[model samples]
Target: MSSDLVRFDATRLAGMIRAREVSPVEVVRAHLDRIEAVDSRINAIVTVAADALGAARAAEAAVLAGEDVGPLHGVPFTAKDSIDTAGVMTQRGSPIFRGRVPEADATSVARLKAAGAILLAKTNLPEFSYSTETDNLLTGRANNPWDLGRTPGGSSGGESAAIAAGMSPLGLGTDLAISVRGPAANTGIVGLKATHGRVPMTGIWPRVPRRFWHVGPMARSVRDVALAYSLLAGPDGEDGFSTAGLGVDAGVGREPSRPLRVGWLVEPGFGPIDPEVAATVQAAAEALRGVGCLVEPVRIPALERDDALEIFWRLHVMEVKPAFAEVTRGREGEMFAISRAMLAEPDTSVADFVRAEQAAERLRDGFADYFGGHDALLCPVLPIPAHAHGLSEFVINGRAVPATHSLSATVPLNVTGLPGLSIRFGTSRDGLPIGVQIVSGWWAESTVLHLASLLEATSPVRDLRPAI
Candidate 1:
């Protein structure tokens, strides 16, 4: 029963809980037990909520009293450690803030709580949430549940690992470049990097480069991600960037009025993509076409002309370094390898910063042009599947590339402030998960989520669980 409960996605769990077939206590305890059984091996969870059961009991009482409940009533969800949780430890995966607890919930966390979801726990991340893999001096490292030697990707690595390993059905992960989608691709799950500022960044850390940072949902299914987005979307009036009104429909069960035009790509733009990963992107395009949408192979010249990953690094370092320097002023020795490496990088000059900003605008304009002719874009989430942990270099399709190249496919969306979704659509030869990215124009997350649901329904790899 516990195994079955753990395997259920958040949408199904919420339905079952509302139907009174599963008690809130039963649901919460099952997850807690699952965590106890599996998390030591994965190291995904940094802190389990002590009052989770108490919250569950209260939910059960409300249900018994025939009171109204929220969409995620009694369902359990987790958040990356960098996302503040009221009364819960949010150490930001760094020793500089060890034992720190927030007095209030982040807008995302508060919204989930408002939806009746229990805060299951806080997951791990790299130091200051600034690395490609989930490891920090505070929480050690997070291992992929699929292959213990591999990573789930970071800074949302622990969140992806937890959901993939059945430790949590749904989670919140923040993405600056590839933190949310890359990890989801690595672990074979669903992650959404909604339009920048669509979800507020009121309580997340490292707000220096607030323009690039985004808080989003990572889950086992697209519906859960869409549902989470619906609740987490509107502005809280605290984050200046989140002032945009929530106008997208979320489109879980709706279809487009006309045939949706989608363009898929795998080369020239996103650096060296593995052949297998490229094929997976092609397969997804074909699947969308099979579903009666207008799908074709397409490319944007901006992606090929200006490297999105390079632009991201150039722009972010200018803002990030000063913040890191301020936070770690006297505690430099407490830093991890990733944080130290970031601090050690050559500073971005004024000329370079201005150039990158101009390049970013060009990238956004490029996407705007593409969207003028298409409703959505389909592409690979990562060039390859999950790699062995702690490696800073990689060779993809016989081309040597830096580890930061993994962010190539994802950073463009961040640079453009576009919405994108990552869902597992294929398995690698080594039995790893391969995810395809679905992106749409600004404020068109409904289009992204709509197409994702269609693909999810026809996905060949749907519901394939990791054998952890």
Candidate 2:
């Protein structure tokens, strides 16, 4: 039981803990031991919480005392280093923030703690959480659990890797472009980027471009993602952008009563997809069709527009980079190469910035029209499977595309402030995981979760675990 305990999702672990099948202390110890054994090769965890054992002991005592327990009572979890953890280093994967500690946990972390979830460790990310691959000067690179030679997608790479390797059952990861979903897709786990404001981003690092940035859950199963989402979603009164969903369920058992209209796309207007990846995504659609959904292949013209990536970049340059310019003025050399390069680029003109904003508006409106006729949309999470550790670009199907093209599928939802989720559904010929992204209208996480849950039910990779 101890050896297999790490493979269970948080939902299952919580139930076992509630049934007294296992003690909280034992659960935490099993994971800590697993991390100690495997994390050296994966570099997933940055800092193990010094007081994790103490927390577990207290949780064990509560269960023995027969006190009321929270839904996640005693389940151990990890947080991306960018999310604040009181008295623990929240270094944002940069040498500049080394030794930094927060006086209080981020809103989501505090809520998780209050619900009795024990924090076991903080995971690694790319420096400033800006890149797609999780590597930093402070904590180093987080390797993919599926293949050590491959990468766990960034900036939530460490969180995904740790969960895939069973070091932690659940974690918090932020997403702007593909931070959460991309990593989940790459690592064959579950990741949710709820409606932009569904989860508050209070206490998260580099809190710029508030409209696009999001913090959400990553877990081994969609049920666990739903469980964490229930606790983490809602306005915290601190983050203005988090005011949309004040109290939302994680949408676990709320399956749609009627047949769902699910639109799936393998092309999605994003140029160049690996044939294997497209087939896996199409297979997900078939699974949905098997589950009584009206799954159809469709395309979004706005998303297909080649300018979508350019628009996302324009907004990033105009809004996000300038927000951090003051702090990074003298320390550009200390940042990641990607971050420095982005900062070094010429500023966007007012006309271009306005055009980009309009493009985003078009995307939001386009999704609105598309969702009016469909309950959810399914697409490939990435054009290709997780690539080598440090390749800047990947050649997909036959076309050589820029590495940042990885964001093409995800940024449309980000631009629209809608909900998007990634769930593992298939495996590549090389045994790598492939995931499909589910998107829904603004503030429609329930719809997204419902479809994702359906897909999860029949996914061939549902029970698959990485050979880490």
Candidate 3:
């Protein structure tokens, strides 16, 4: 019964709970049991909520009493450690902030709780949520469920691993360049990095580089992500970026009035993509074309002109370093390697900073131009499948590239504040998950989620699960 319960997505669990076919206690217990059974191997969970079962009992009582409930009523969800939970320890995967617990939930976490979802646990991440791999001094490392030797990707790696392993059905993850989407791609799950500021970042760490950071949902299904996004979006009064008013349409199951137009790309701009990963992107484009959408091969000149990864580094490092320095001020000895590496990066020169700012604008303008003729743009999420833990470089298409090159396909969307979703559509020759990215113009999360749902319905790899 626990096995069956853990297999269901958040939407399925919510429906079953609502119908009284399963009680909230049973659902929560199944997940807690799953975590105990699998988390030691994965190391995805940092701190399990002490009050989770208590909360579940309350939810079950409410359901039995026939009280009104929210859409995610009785469902259990996890959050990356970087996202604050009212009483749960949010260690930020660093020793500098060890034993730290937020007095209040982040807007995202509070919103989920308000929707009647119980806080299941807090997941792991890189120290200060800065690295592309999920390992830190505090929680050690988070291993991918598919192959324990590989990573699930980071800084949202632990959240993706937990969802893929069925330890949690849904969770929240923040993305700067590739945190959410890249990890989801690595783990064969669905992750949404909604338009920047669509969801408030009020309670997440490192608020300095706010423009590039985004908080969104990561789950086992596209519909779950869409549902969470609907509930999480809108203004929170505190986050200046989250000024978008309520009532944004999620468009999960809705089809467009006319055939949607999508363009697919794999190269020249996004650096070197593996043949398998590139084929996955093409397959997704063909699948959309097969579904009667106007799909074609296309390119955005700005990505080719100004390297998005370079631009992101130049702009974000300048903004993020100070915040890191501030938090680690007196505790330099407790810092992790990634944090040290970040601090060691030379400051962005005035001339380079100006150039990067202009290049970012060009990237945004380039996407604007492309979206003028297409509703969505499809591309590879990463150059390769999940690499070995602690790998700092990779060889793609017989060419050597720095580890940061993996962010190539994703950083463009961050630079433009565009909404992007990563969904598993193909499997690598190594038996790893490969995902295709679907992106849309600003404030077009509806379009992104709508198209993702269509793909989800037709995905050949839909039923695949990690052997773990």
**Clash counts for the predictions, in order:** 0, 1, 0
**TM-scores of all predicted structures:** 0.98, 0.97, 0.98
* Candidate 1 per-residue C-alpha lDDT over 254-342 given as tens digits, one digit per residue, 9 for 90 to 100: 66688988999998798689999999999999999999999988989999889888898899888888888999999999999878888
Name the regions of candidate 3 deviating beyond 4 angstroms: 246-253
TM-score of 3: 0.98
Quantify all predictions' global Cα lDDT against the true fold.
0.92, 0.87, 0.92
State the local distance difference test value for candidate 3.
0.92
For 1-468, candidate 2 gives per-residue lDDT tens digits of 788899888999899998999998999999999999999999999999999999999998998899999999999999999999999999999877889999999999999999999999999999888899998788898899999999999999999999999999999999988999999999999999998888899999666668889999999888899889888988889898887663453332366678888888877476588888898888999998998889889988877663667887888777877766766788777787777877778889999899888888887777788888988888888889899988877888677888888888887777777888999888989999998899877777887888888888888878888877
lDDT of 3 by residue, 201-253 (tens): 99998866699999999999988998999899999999998888545543323
